[model samples]
Target: MFRVLALALVLSVSFAGVVPNPATDGDRGEYVTLSVPENTSLGAYTLADGETTVRLPDRTVSGLVALAADPALARNLTDARVVRVPGFPRLANGGETLVLRRNGTVVDRLTYENAPESEVFADGGWRPLGATDFQTATASDVAVSAFALPDAPQRVLAALRGAEERVLLAGYTFSSPRVARVLAAAADRGVRVRVLVEGGPVGGVAVNSARVLGDLAAAGVEVRVFDGPRSRYAYHHAKYAVVDDRALVTSENWKPGGVGGHATRGWGVVLRNPAVADHLAAVHAADSTWRDGVAWSTYRANATFQDGAPATAAYRSDFAAWNGTADASVFVTPEDGHQTTLGVLRNASERLLVQQVHIDDARFLNATLDAARRGVRTRVLLGGAWYVREENRALVERLRTTARDEGLPLRARVVDPRSRFDHLHVKGVVTENAALVGSLNWNHESVVENREVMVQLRGGAVADYYARVFRADWRGGVWRLPLCVLAVTVGIVLGAAGVMWRRVSFSGSGRSGVPRRVPRPPSSR
Candidate 1:
C-alpha cells in the first residue's frame, strides 16, 4: 500500500506540472480523456476491434476510468491524455474549445449541450475529434494527422511534398517513377531517404527493392537494402517510414503494387508523432532475422550506404523501451511466434480493434468471438473488394456470422485500385488502453513460417490516431458497398490471385526442373 502511494507521490512531484492526465499519447497516437457530466449518456463510439461506452451525467470524465472499466476500450487507448472539460469541469463544447491548449498548456475549456459540428454532420467532410459532445480534444490534435487521404490521392502526394528531413522506407517492392521522384526530391532538398528493401531470398522482392534504390541513389538519396534471410522463419515483409518523429507503419509495401494480392488490400498508418516514429525505428533496427543481403547486378546497385553511417542499426536494449502504463497496456509475444498476438487481443478487458488485409484463421475467429461473448467489445476489419479468393470469402462469411451471434461489429473494406494487389498485412491490436504493431498476420505462415517483428507502444499520440484510423475503416471508410454486395462481389472480382497463381505454378515444375546445382568444381578434378 505504501509503495503504490509512494509511487504516485513521486510521479506527482517529478511531473509536478504534469497532471494525472486523463489523456495519454501512445507511440501510434494520442488519446484524450473526456468526462461526461453526471447522468449524461454517451453515444457508442466503435472502431475496428474496440468500443467505448460513455455514461452520461457522470461525476467524472476520466478517459482513464472509461478505458479501465472496459477491456475493449482499453486495448485501443495505449495512452490517456487528460483534459478537464470546463464549466461543468465535467463537460466541454464548441469549436472554441480548439484553443483548449495553447503553447502546450491547457487553458479555457468549452461547455456545450451538444456537438458544435452538428451543422457539418450532413456532409461527408466532418472529422470526429473524439466522441460526440465537446468532450476532450481530438485524437488528431494530440498526434500528427494522416494526410486525410480518403478524401484525395493528391492529399497523399501533398503529404510527401511536405517532407523536410529524413525518410526511411521499408517495402517489398517499389517501381513508380512518381514515387521515386518524390523521394529524390526530398533527398535533393537534404532530406535523408534510406530504403531497406526485402530482396532475393524472399521471392526476389529484393529485385524490386533494387530497382527503387538504384533510382533513388541517382536522384541523390541515401539508400540501403537489407537482404532478407531464410533461416528458421519466413522472409521479412514490413513497410513503413520514419521522417523524424513522425512515422508510418504499414501493411502495404509502398510499391507500384502497393499491397499485393487483390483478394485483400493492405492498410497502413501515417504516424505523425515521436513515440510511434521512434518505436518503428527500433523495430526496423531489430530485424536481424532478415540479414540475407543480395547484390543486384542488373538493377541500380548504387543505393549503398555511405561509409560514415552505421552499417546496421544497434539493437536497443529491449528493457529500456519507454512504454508507459497509463491504464493503457501493450504486451508483445516477445518470441518468433505470431499466434501469441491472438492471446493478447482475446484477453482484452473492454474492446479489441483488429485490422488486417486477410483474416481467416479459425483460431483468430474463435478468439474474437470469445472476447466479445465475455462482454468485451470485439470488432474486426477484414479485406473486402481487393480479394477474390474463395478461402477469403469463406473467412468473411465466418466473421460475419460470428459478429451476428456475438453482437460484435465486423466490417470489410475495399482498397482502392482494386486491380493491383493491396498490402494490408499489418498485425496490430488496440485492446482497451493499449496498442501493438508488427509484421505478424492472422495466418498460418505468420505463426510458424514467418519470423515476424511486432512492438507494443505505450501511451502516446500514435495509438489514438491508430484507434481513429481503425474506427474509420470499420465504419466503411472507403468501401461504399453494402455488406452482402461486398461478399457477393468477392466471388468475381479482379481475379488477380487466381490468375497469378496459375501462371506461376504452370510455368514451374520439379525433379528434372529442379534448381540446378553449380557443378562442383571437379571436387577432385
Candidate 2:
C-alpha cells in the first residue's frame, strides 16, 4: 500500500512539472503568437478563448506557435509551427484573456490590456518584432579616411588586403568579383575572413551573388546568409566591414556597381578606431551567430537565384581620399538610427544638404521641410537612375512647387551624372557642424524593420569634406530650363526673325510695284 502511494506521488509531481508556461501573448490582431514552453508536449492540453476550446497538436513545441486566422500569415511562417485555427477567437486589440489547460485543469493564463499594434508582449513589456537595443556610441578624435565611390574603390580593396588578423564583412548584397578576389587572397594569407549578407533580398538572390559567395566558401572564407523564417530583421541591409581594428562603413553594396567602382555614386569612410571596430564586430557576431544566420552553402542549396547582369561600366576617379580626425557617433537601426538622424535634421541651424536614392518617407520629408520653415537652407538631391527617374522627377516638381508656394529656402532636384559616375546611390547628410554617411535609407521600413548602419562625424572639417562633394554633385544636379520653356523661347526668337524677313520682303516687293502686307511678330506669353 505504501509503494502504491509513493508511485502516485511521483506521477503527480511529473505531471505537475510538465505544465506549459505562458511566456508571450502576441496580439497582432488577425493572428496571435502562443509561446509554449520548450520541450513541453501539448498532447493533453487545450487553448481556450473563454468561449471555444481547441486541442493543441500532440507534439512537443520548439518554442513559439502561431494561431493565425489568415492563411497568408501562416504561409509566411516557413520556419515556425503554425495552427490554422479557423474561427480562432480574435485577440481584442484593447484587451483580452487567454487560458491554457491540461487534462481539464488550468495550466497557464494570460491577461493583457491596451495591447499595442504589431507588437509582442513578454517579460512585462511590449516591443516590436525584431527590435534591437543598441545605443549610440561616441568616439572622440578618431582618425577617419573618407572617400567617394567610383573614385576610391581602391581604398576598400586596400583595407581588405591589409587585414592582418580578421575581416568581418556585412552587407545587403555581395557580388563584386574584385572584392571577392581580395578577400580570397586575404583568407589564403591566414587572415580570418567571414562575410554576412541578406539571403532574401528583393526579387530573390542574384545568380552572380550566389556564384561569388560559393567561390568565397571554397576559398576557405566563412560565409553566412541572414535568412530563415526566424530572421530578426526584415532584411539585413547594413553595408559595412570590420577589418582588424578598422571599420569601413558605406552606403553602397558589395556589388560591382557599388564598391567595385564600376558605377553608382556613394560615400564611404574607413575609421581607424578600435572601439568602433569592436562595436561593429559585436553586431556582426550577434547577427551572424544567430540561429537564423544559416551557412551560405545551406541557403544556396534551397534558394532559387534570379538572373542578373553584373555592373561592368567603368568611370574615372574624381575625388581623392580625405584623411582627418573627428568625433564620430556610430548608430544602427532599428534602434537609434531614426532618432539620431532626426536629431541631426532638427538641430541644423544653418543649412541641410541631403543626397539619396529617394526620400519616400513622409516623416523625414516633413523634418526637412520643418528645418526649411525654421529658416534653415535646405537642398535635396536625388538619384537620376532609369528606375527612379520618373518618380524623382515628380518628387522634384512637387518640392519645387511647395517651396515656391510657401516661400521656403528649400530646393530639390534630380542629379545629372555628367559622366562623373552613374546614379547617386548615396545616403548622406551634410550640415555646417556634422555629416552623416551610411546605409540607412530615409524610409519607414528601413528605419524600423531593416538592419542599417550610419555614422555621424561631428566636426567642421569632416562636414566640409562631404559638403564639398555635395556642392559638386549639387552643381551637376542644377536645374535647367525645361524642354517646354526652351521650346517657347526658340519659337519667339524664330518668330521675330520671320517677321523681319517678312518686312524686308514686303519692302522689296513694293519696289517691284506691288503692295504687300508685313506679318506681325508673335507675342511672348
Stretches of candidate 1 above 4 Å error?
Answer: 1-165, 189-191, 200-211, 226-233, 256-267, 270-279, 282-291, 295-340, 347-350, 360-363, 385-388, 399-439, 447-525
Clashes of each: 69, 0
**After superposition on all CA atoms, how large is the RMSD of candidate 2?**
13.6
Which of the numbered candidates is closest to the native, going by highest TM-score?
2
Estimate the TM-score of every prediction: 0.46, 0.71
Q: In model 1, how large is the Cα lDDT of residue 43?
A: 27
Q: How far does residue 383 in candidate 2 sit from its true spot (Å)?
A: 1.2
RMSD of candidates 1 onward, in order? 24.1, 13.6
What C-alpha lDDT does candidate 1 achieve relative to the native structure?
A: 0.44
Tens-place lDDT per residue, model 1, 404-453, is 77576554333232222223344667776556665566777665544344
Consecutive 10-residue window with the lowest summed lDDT within model 1: 13-22
